[model samples]
Target: MTVSAWWFLLVGAIVTYGWRAAGVALSGRIDPNSALMRWVACVAYALLAGLIARLIVAPQGALGDTALWMRLSSAGVALLVYFIFRRSIVLGVTAGALWLMAVTTLAGG
Candidate 1:
């Protein structure tokens, strides 16, 4: 809405795209099967798992207000839907969100 905000957005876009462009430039030379790549992949998965665990176990804000069992149940439903839909992330997340809302409202949380 302001000049400063526009400048900030422009800078953010430039920085984000700069790294992406560099990655694209270097991608041809990087070996997907290399040990370094494997390590990176493992680290990424570990970080994701840790974040998910934290959100479920000790969430902040609105989610924190919900009961632990509700959170766990939603996560279970999400996982089940994920597998049932052949690992479709969109469907899994949608089902989980819908389930969480329904349960929370029904239980008067």
Candidate 2:
């Protein structure tokens, strides 16, 4: 990468860890159950949900090309399998990956 791009990466890393470092420095100084902490947790979850939504709805490359209904249905089946099988996250992820592969094959994509 160019020097400018390398500097951007370094700055991004510093900013990312700066937040963690600040949190760590403040940890125990503030109550974990405080409103600020809850709000931060909610924001974190919202970001996570947004990322998943984008992956499911907008995707990219090979994934973006998959049928939307098939993708949603595959996720649903995986979730069902996860709940029905004693809530095994590993099995759930595996089932989702397998489901997507099967759907892709069935769709001839």
Candidate 3:
């Protein structure tokens, strides 16, 4: 790679690690059970839910090409797998992705 590309990569790594280092340094002082922490968690979950809803309702890129019913069915299957599997995120995501791919392929989407 070019020198500029290497420099950009180095800078990106430094910036990413800088935040992580700062988080680690401050983690000891932060109270996980505090009201502020609870609020942050709630906001995080809300943002995640909103993003998921948007993706299912009006996706972009290749996902937008698929039918709404296909997306909704995949999401339903994912949720069912998630709950049945004791809320395992990895399993839920894998199930959703596989279901979408299978449906898209079979339906020629």
Candidate 4:
């Protein structure tokens, strides 16, 4: 990469780390169980959910090559497996990945 690219990366890293450090410094002063904190948590979760839904509905790159139904089906199965396994993250992820691979292969992708 060019020197400019390296410079940008360094600046970006510093900025990101600065924000993280600031957050850490302020963490003790903030009320973790405050209403504002609860609202922020809810908003963060909603944003994450929206992003995941958008990706499943209109994926990009390799994921986009797979059919929407296949992705949805895999996600559904993963959720089911997660619940059935008492929310084991490992099993849930494995089930989702395996389902996606099997569906994609069987579909002749």
lDDT (10s digit) by residue, model 1, range 1-109: 4477889989999998997897899898988789987998899899999998999989999989999999999999999999999999999999999999999999994
Off by over 4 Å in 1: 1-19, 81-92
Task: Give all candidates' CA lDDT scores.
Answer: 0.92, 0.90, 0.92, 0.91
Q: Candidate 2, after superposition: displacement of residue 86 in Å?
A: 1.1
Residue runs of model 2 more than 4 Å from their true location after superposition: 1-8
User: Candidate 1 vs candidate 3: which has greater TM-score?
Assistant: 1
Error of 3 at 94 (Å): 4.0
State the TM-score for model 4: 0.75
Ranking by TM-score: 2, 4, 1, 3
Q: Which run of 10 residues does model 2 get worst, by summed lDDT?
A: 1-10
List model 4 lDDT by residue over 63-82, tens digit each: 99888999999999899999
Better model by lDDT, 1 or 4?
1
Q: Which lDDT value does model 2 have at 23? A: 84
TM-scores for the candidates: 0.65, 0.81, 0.63, 0.75
RMSD values, in order shown: 4.6, 2.7, 4.9, 3.5
Q: What residue runs in model 3 are displaced by over 4 Å at the alpha carbon?
A: 1-19, 83-92
Instruction: For candidate 2, report its TM-score.
Output: 0.81
lDDT of 3 by residue, 3-109 (tens): 77889989999998997897799898988799987997899899999998998999999889999999999999899999999999899989998999999999994
